[model samples]
Target: MLLSLFTVLLWGQQKETQEQLERRKQQILIEIKSVQQLLQNERTKERNILAEIEEQNRKINLSRQLIKNVQQQITITNASIKKNQKEADELQAELYKLKEDYAATILKTYKSRSNQSRIMFILSSDNFLQAYKRIQYLKQYADFRKEQGQEVKAKSEELSKALVRLEEQRESQKKLLAEQQQNEKNLQKDLDQQKGLMAIVQKDQKKYNDQIKKKQDETKAIDRKIQQLIREAIEEANRKAREAAAKAGKETTKSVGSGKNATFELTPEGKIVANSFKANMGKLPWPVEKGYISLPYGDQPHPVQTHLTIHNSGVEITTEGGSKARSVFQGEVLQVQVMPGGNKAVLIQHGDYITVYQNLSEVYVKKGDAVALKQSIGTIAANSTGKTVLKFLLSHNTDINNPQLWLSRSN
Candidate 1:
C-alpha cells in the first residue's frame, strides 16, 4: 500500500512538471512568432545599418532564448525516457516472475488431476459431506490456476506498453536536439552580423556618439516630464480623497512611504481599486496585445558603447505598425499631453498608482474619461525610421517602478 501511494504521488508530480514545461514551451513559441513579425516589419522599409543592427540584436536575443527553452524541453524528455526505461525493466521482470509462477501452478494442477475424473475423485471420499468438500477443493484449485494465467498475460501487455512509451520519449528528445542545433546556428549568424555592424559603427564613432547623446537627452526630458505629470496626478488624487473624507466627517490619514515618495491616502472606492491593482501585480496585461520588450527599464550601459549609458524611465515595447495601445487596467484618464516630438502620452489614474502610455500618434480617450481595462486609448505612432515603439511607465506617487515587474510575462 505504501509503495502504491508513493507511485501515485510521484506520478502526480511528474505530470505537473510536464504541464509547466509545456506551458513555458508554448510561451516561448509565441515570443518567437512575435519577434519574427517585428523582424519582417523592419525588413520591409528602407534599409539603415543602425536599424539592421538593432533588428539583428533583437533576433539574436530571441534565438538564444528559444534555444534555452528547447534545451529545457530536451532535459525533460530525457528524464521521461529514463523513467520509462526503468518502468519497462521492472515490468519485464514482473512478467518473467508471473510466467514462472503460472507454469508451476499449471504443472501442479495437472499432476494432481492426471488420473482422476471429477466424479471419480468425489466417489473416493468416505461420505456425502466429504465428497462435497472434495468437489469444492477441485473448483478452487482450477480457479487459482486460471487467475495465475491471467496475471501473466496482464504483466506481458504492461511491459510491451512501457517499451513503446520509452521509444516515443527517445524520439521526442531527438527532435528537440535538432531544433536546438538550428536555433544555435541562427543565433551565431545574427551574432556575426551584429559584429560586422559594430565595426562599421565604430568607424563613424563620433557621429554615432552624437546621435546617442541626443537620444539620451531626449529620454531624460521625457522621463522628467512624465514624473512631473505623475506627481500632479498624485496630488490631485490626495486632494479629492481629503475632501471626500471631510464630507463624510472622517479623518484623512497621511500618505505612506518615505522621503519624497509617498502613496496617497485613498477613499473607499479608491482603496478598492488600489487593492485590486496591487493583487494583479505581475499579472496585468500588456498595453499592446502583442510585442517584445526592446528597451527595458532603468539605467544600463549602451549596447554598442559600454562607456556610454542609457537611462529609461520605463520599458520600450516594439510592436507592429498601426497597432493601438490599450489601457492595462480600469482607470480615469488624468491627462493626454502632447510631447515635444509631436508624440502623445496618456496618463491614467488607478487609485494611488499612475500608468503612462507614451508615443501615441492619436488620442482616443480625453482627460476625465473613465476607461475600462484593455480599452484602446490611442494608436501607436509608426516612426519614419520604420520603428513602432511604445513607452510604458508605472509609478506609485513620486516613485517610479519598473513596468516590466507589473506587467505579465511576454508570450
Candidate 2:
C-alpha cells in the first residue's frame, strides 16, 4: 500500500508539470490577442478577423492535448489507487495478527504468577545451577512479551501513515481531473468566439472576393519572377567555369537548407544572416511590434467549411492600425511589388536568405536600397477590418517556412 501511494504522488507531480506547460501556451495566445485586439479596433483591416480565428484554433488545439493528457493520468491513477487499497488490506490483516499475539503474550506473562511469586520461586532453588537456570527462563519470557507489544505498536503506526498518504494521492488526482474539465470548457468558449468571427468574415466575403482574386493574380506574378531569378542564378553558375561545376559553381561546396540558400553567389551578408538565424532559433525577433497572424504557411482547413481546404504560401500577421512592417535582417531590397488585396509587398535578400513583408499601405524603401535588421520598410495596411496582422515570410530562395517554428517563442 505504501509503495502504491508513493507512485501516485510521483505521477501527480509529473501531471502538474505538464499542466504548467499547457498553461504557458494559453498565456502566450492571450497576451498576443490582447495586443492585436487593440490594433484591430484602430484599423478597418479585414485580416484582423483572420488573426483572431487562427489564435482561437491554436488555443483549442492546446486544450484538446491537455484533455488527452489528463485522461491518461486518470487511468494510471485509478490503477495505482486499486493497488494501494490491496496493500492497505494486507497491512490491516497483519495489524490484527500483531494485536492478537501481543494480547496473548501479555495474558500468559501476567496470569502465570504475581511479580513477587516469580522472584520467590526462582530464589528458592536448592543449588547455584538451579538458581541460574530459573532466572534465565524468566528473562526469556519477559523479553518475548515486550517484543510482541512493540510489533503491535509499529504495525498500527505504519497503517495510519499509509492511509494518510493514500488520501493525499486521491485528492491530487481529483484536482487534476477537475482542471482538465475546466480546460474543455474554455475550449468551447473559444470555438464560439471563432464562429462569431467567421460570420463577420463571411458577411464581407462577396465584398472582398474580387479583391482576393486580384491578390491571387499578383501572387502568381511574384512566383513567376522568383522562377526567373532562380533560372538566372543557375545560368550564372554554369557560365563561371572556375567555380566548382560539380556543386552549383561555388568556390567551395557548401550546405544550403533551412535559412541557408545559395550554391553559387552567396554574398557575405547572406552567410551571416543564415548563421544568425540558426544560432538564434528560439530567440528570433518578432516581425511586428504587436500583431497576430490570421493566415498561416501551409494547407489549412477553411474556417467556414470543414471539408474545404486553403493553401497559403506564407503566414499573414495582422498588426495594429498604421503599424509598419520591418526587415528582420540586413539585406538589399530586391523588389517592391503592388501586391493583391490592394496592398504593397517588399522582398529583401540577406545573402541567400530572403524575407517577404506584405500588406503594406506605403513603401519606405526602394529596390536596391540596403536595409538593416528590424528597419521599417512600409507601414502595415490600415483600414484592415479586424486586426492589423503582418504576413511575415522567410525563404531560402524558394522553399516556404513555418514562421511559428522559426521565430522565437514570445515570453
Candidate 3:
C-alpha cells in the first residue's frame, strides 16, 4: 500500500514537471523568434556596425536563456527517470515476494492433492454432519489457493508494466539530454558571433561612440518632450476632472499637488479605467506585434561601450520595418507630436495611466480619438541609419514606469 501511494505521488510530480517544462520551452521559442526578427532587420541596414552588435548581443542573451531552459528540462527529466527506476525496483521486489508466497501455497496444496484420498478421509468421519463439515473445510482451502494464484498472476503483469514504463522514461531522458547538448552548441555559436562583433566594435570605437552619442542625445530630447506632454495632459485631465466633480456637487481634492510635477485627480469613470489598467500590470500586450526589447528601460551599460552607461526612460523595441505600432489597451489618443527628425509619437491616455509610442513614420489616429486594445496607431519609422526601432514608454500621472514590466514577456 505504501509503494502504491508513493507511485501515485511520483506520477503527479512528473505531470507537474512536464507542464513547467512545456511552458518554459514555449517562452524560449518566442524569445528566439523575436530575436531572429530583430537580426533580420539589422541585416537590412547598410553597415551599421553598432546595430549589428546590439542585435547579436540580444541574440546571444536569448540563446543563453534557451540553453538555460533546456538544461532545466534535462534536470527534471533526469529526476523523473530516477524516480521511475526506483518505483520499478520496488514493484519487482514486491512481485518476487508475492511469487514466493504463492509457491509455498502451491506446495501446501500439493500435499492434499488427490481427490479420491480426500473423499476416503471424509468418509472415515463418525457421522453425516462431521463429513459435511470436512467437505466444507476442503472447499474453502481450495478457494484460498486459487485466489493466491490469481494474485500472483496480477502482480506479475503489474511488474511487467512497470518495467516497460521505466524503459520508456529512460528513453525520454536520453532525448532530453541530446536536446540540451544541441542547445549548448547553439549557445556557443552565438557567443562566437558576439565575440566577432565585439572585435569590430572595438576597432571602430570612435565612430561608433559618436553615433551612439548622437542617438542618445536624440533619445533624451524625445523623452523630455514626451514627459512634458504627459505632464500637460495630466494637468488638463485634472482640470476637467475637477470641473466635472464640482458640477456634480462632489468635493474635489487635489489628488496630485499643484506645480510642474503634479498628478491627476480622476473622475469616477477615469478611476475605474485607471484601476483596470493597474490590475493588468505585466499582462498588457506588446506595442508591436513582433519585436524584441533591444534596449531596456532605466540605466544600463552599453553592450559594446562598457565605459558608458545609457539611461533609457523606456524600452526600445527592434521590429520589422513595416510593422505598425499598436495600442496595448483601450485608450484615447491624447496627442500626436513630431520629433526634431520628423519621427512622430502618439500618446494615448488610459485614465490616469498613459502610454507613448515613439519613432512612428505616420499617425493613424488624431487627438482625442478613441482606440481599442491592440489598435494600430502608426507605422514604425525606419531611421536614416536603417534601423526600425520603436521607443515605448508607460507612466502613471507624473511617475515613469518601465515598459518592460508591463508588456507581455512572451509577446
Candidate 4:
C-alpha cells in the first residue's frame, strides 16, 4: 500500500511538471503570435517579429516531437515492465525449487551422518572409479546450487531497476505531453490573430490601392526630377573628365577612383550632401516598418485593376491599417508635393542617388532641408475609402532600382 501511494505521488508530481512545461510552451507560442501580428501592423514599428515567429515555430515543433518520443517510451516501458514481471515470477519459482533441493540434500546428509554409514554408502559405489565419480559429483552439485542462488539475486535486482526506469519514462511522457498540448493552444491563438489581420487588410484593399496609386504617381514625378538632375550631373562630369584628361593626362595613372574632374563640380554644400549619401549605401533603412513588397521596381500590375498593367518606378510595400513614409537615406529635401485625394510625397537628393517617400498625409521637411536616414518625412495618407500605405523609391538620375536591393535588409 505504501509503494502504491508513493507511485501515485510520483505520478502527481510528474503531472504537475507536465502542466508547468505546457504553460511555458503556451507562453512562447503566444509571443510568437504577437510578433506575427506586429508584422501585420500598419505602423510596422520595428518589424523584428518575423524572426521571432520563425524561432518560436522551430521550438514548438521540437517540443511536439519530444512529446511524441516520450509517449512511445511510455508504451515501450510498460511492455518491458510486464515482461520483466513475468520473468521475475519464473525466477522466484526456480529459486524456491533450488532452495528445496538444497534443503533435501542437507537433510539426507544429516540423517545418514555417521563415519561408518558414510563408508558403507561409499562402499555401495562398488568400484574405486565409481567412488571417485561420486565425490566429483557432490562438488559439482554444490557449485550449481551457488550459481542458481546468484542468478535469482541478479534477476531480482534487474526487475527492481527496470520498474524504476519505467516510472521515469511514464513521468516524462506526462510532462512532455502537457507541453505539446499547451503549444498547440498557443498556435491556435496566433492563427486567429493573423486571420483577423488578414481580414482587416482585405476589407481595406480598395482604400489601400487608391493610396498606393497616388503614391506611385508621386514617385514617378520624383523619378523624372531626379533623372533631369542626373543627366545634368553626368554631362558636367563628362565635360570635366575631358578637361582633366587634357590638363592632367600624365596624372591620370595616379588616381584609381572616379575621375577627379567629377569631384570639382559640386559646391561645398552639394559636396557635403553627395558625400553623406555615398557613405551610407547598403546602410539606409526602409521607408516603412511593416509590409511585404507586392510590386517591386520596373513594371507591375495595377493593384486595383489587375487586368490594367502599369510601370512602377519603385516598389510598393503593402501593410496593415496605418503607416508613415520616411527617408531611406540622408539628403537634401528637393520637394514635398500634396497630391489629389489627400496624399503627399517627399523627394530627397544625395550626390548621385535620389530617394523618394510617397503616400504621405503630411510633410515634415521643406525643399533644401537635409533629411537623415529613417527620418519621418510625413505620415502616409489614407486613400479614398480610408486605408494607409507608403510608396517608396530609389533611383540614380533616370534609372529606377529595386528598393529591395538598396535598403539595408536588417531594417
Best candidate, lDDT: 3
Q: After superposition, how far is residue 94 of candidate 4 from its true place, in Å?
A: 35
By TM-score, who's the top model here?
1
lDDT for model 4, on a 0 to 1 scale? 0.59
Better of 1 and 2 by TM-score: 1
Across 1-411, the per-residue lDDT of candidate 2 in tens digits comes to: 997788778768766865665576565556545644563443443445554565566556646765676666677667667766777888999999888888888777678768788988788999889999999989987887878788888888888987886897799779868977887787788778778877887788765455545545665675555545543443343244335443554353243442224333544444676677556655667778765555667887754444556666677765557787887767777777775457777877665556777778899999779898788889887533444656777765565567677776652
What C-alpha root-mean-square deviation, in Å, does candidate 3 show against the real structure? 2.8
What is the Cα-based lDDT of residue 345 in candidate 1? 97
Models ranked on TM-score:
1, 3, 2, 4
Candidate 1 Cα lDDT to native: 0.82
For model 1, the stretches where C-alpha displacement exceeds 4 angstroms are 113-133, 240-265, 383-385
Clashes of 3: 0
Off by over 4 Å in 2: 1-205, 208-294, 305-308, 317-383, 405-411
What TM-score do all the candidates reach, one by one?
0.90, 0.56, 0.89, 0.40
Better of 2 and 4 by lDDT: 2
lDDT of 3 at 337: 91
Worst 10 residues of 4 by lDDT: 252-261
